[model samples]
Target chain A: MRVRVLYFGVLKELFACPSEDVEVETGCNVGALRKVFHGRMPHTAWKSMAIAVNQEYAGDEVLLHEGDEVALLPPVSGGAPGNVPWKKIILPSPRTV
Target chain B: MQIAIVREVIDAGSITAALKAGADGAVCVFDGIVRDNTRGRRTLYLDYEAYEEMALNQMRNLAEEAIAKFGVRDIAVVHRLGRLYVGESSVLIAVASAHRGAAFEACRWLIDTLKKTVPIWKKEQFEDGAVWADGEPFPEEIVRG
Candidate 1:
């Protein structure tokens, strides 16, 4: 079976090329897919990353299906205001002691 | 005025065209680009997947709210759905207002709300591997207040 894993934000830097399809073995779960990705980039901290299956957030235990559009999202730098579009607000840092 | 998740990269010209006759005193455009690196790894590109219907609806809702709450004149929010290369425009936001302050406030409000309410997820493709963003989870309560 094949799964199309999508990359965005800072996570794209993990691959030589962004946004391509990946071929996985049959009966592979989300965790298994992460293992394959980990093999490609041994330095990646997969545990901190998030996964979404078919546009919905999924856990590592979720099973993968053929043609599943999976995505890997990193921690967003900004906050979600809920009533408006997302914005990045930068504040001044305090002086070091 | 329009909200969509398009496969092609955002067209700046289209955005400008959309806001032409809206009695806008000020127009603000924001372009979100793909950075070259994440953490310690080098990136090749980025891919964005969105719950199309929900995302569009949410974007519209955000726009409407900005107009009502902040008195925005017009707005256009377009985000790329498919693959995007480095430095390509992934997201474009244009907000127009009768005054500059309201326009800025509304634009900020629109983008800030879209991040939380809109069901769009972005994935990162690194040189070593790939990962999924902790995207919007569905089948849950959606509070619009």
Candidate 2:
């Protein structure tokens, strides 16, 4: 059973070869799939990325089935008005009243 | 009238085509463009991609939510896929309502909710490197940011 993996955003540039499809063995979990994908693109950062299966977010332990639509999503810096992940957290110093 | 995801660039006319003078008293539109910089990094371009089926469903859901929450009459949302250069439109959402207040609220909610719920993600290309725009897993942080 072959699972179809879709790459998007910056992940597409990771391949460096322009190949969109990745073939994996049946019953391989998301963690294993990440390994294979990272192996292909050694220079690209694969850690701490998000993966969605069949349009729903999935964990690394999720077992993938055949024909499952998997998409690789990297950290989105800014696109919409609200979402921003890497902002510096500022803490105020304590002052004697 | 319909929710669509196309590979071509988005335009204001396409999203506002469903609006009319008498029928639609207020026309609220949200046009998302590729910004020039992110976190002080100069951006070269943006690459947008989505889960076609689910994205359309999510957009439709936003329309319904707006109608119930803000009483918007007609809504049309079109998101672009593929590469978009600087200053190019990437997402277009228009809401037609009987009143201006509802139209404004509905439009704002639609775009805000769409960012959280939609499966679309954008990759920002910069001179030094590129990064996915807020692609984290946690919804709380992403929503607050």
Candidate 3:
């Protein structure tokens, strides 16, 4: 089986590409696929990364299928720190009042 | 709820105005912009990228969850990709609700959760060099062994 693997964030720099098609043995799960990359990069690099199958987060036990879109997601940093308040505030709900 | 991942600049004012409803008492907006500096280094620009399809999916899920969890009436989340100069709006999140509390809570929660879960990455181009910004660690449940 083959899967279209995607690299995001630093993984793109590490892998030197945005995406690629990888050949994996049939019935291989996400864990097995991760080991393939583990051989390339240091073990610490894999510690915080997450895998997404078909755009949804998947566990290691999740089996991969042919042509599945697997994404290597590094810790995400999306939003900017606006002037919004950082302190957690819990206001009384109108209903509760 | 309106959730989108756009390449063009995000228009925060218009999106916030569009989300307002007669029944809503408040609309909280979080407009995330590119800062001019990181630490002491001067930032030239920022290049943001994402797994588009997956990002959209994750954003939509967050919007829906915010509505249910915080009782926000509606939400519009738009994140821009490609190169963005300093002070440019990189992402916009607006939450509408009948009460101000819900709107405020939802708006904050949406941005916080999106930063952690969304498959978006930012590369900072400093005046001296360029590097990928370190991302916050993923939630434990999302990390695969």
Most DockQ-accurate candidate: 3
**Ranking of all predicted structures according to TM-score, beginning with the best and ending with the worst:** 3, 2, 1
Which window of ten consecutive residues has the lowest lDDT sum in model 1 chain A? A78-87
Candidate 2, B33-88: lDDT as tens digits? 87787667777777677766767876887788788888778887888887788888
lDDT of 2 by residue, A1-97 (tens): 7777777544565554322556677778887887776666534345446677787667777889878888775543323423365322111321221
Off by over 4 Å in 1: A1-97, B135-145
Candidate number with greatest lDDT = 3
Candidate 2 lDDT at A23 equals 68
RMSD of 2: 9.2
True contacts kept of each: 0.04, 0.18, 0.63
Candidate 1 C-alpha lDDT tens digits along B43-145: 6666676646546766777788888998887888888876666787777788887788988888877766666556566555666555544433322233100
Give the worst 10-residue stretch by lDDT in candidate 2 chain A: A88-97
Q: 1 or 3: which has the higher lDDT?
A: 3
Error of 3 at A38 (Å): 1.4
Per-residue lDDT for B27-131 in model 3, tens only? Answer: 999999998886666878878999899899999999989999998788999999998998999999999999999999888888889988898887777655566
The whole-model C-alpha lDDT of candidate 1 against the native structure comes to: 0.63
- Residue B15 of model 1, lDDT score: 83
For every prediction, compared with the true complex, DockQ reads 0.06, 0.14, 0.29
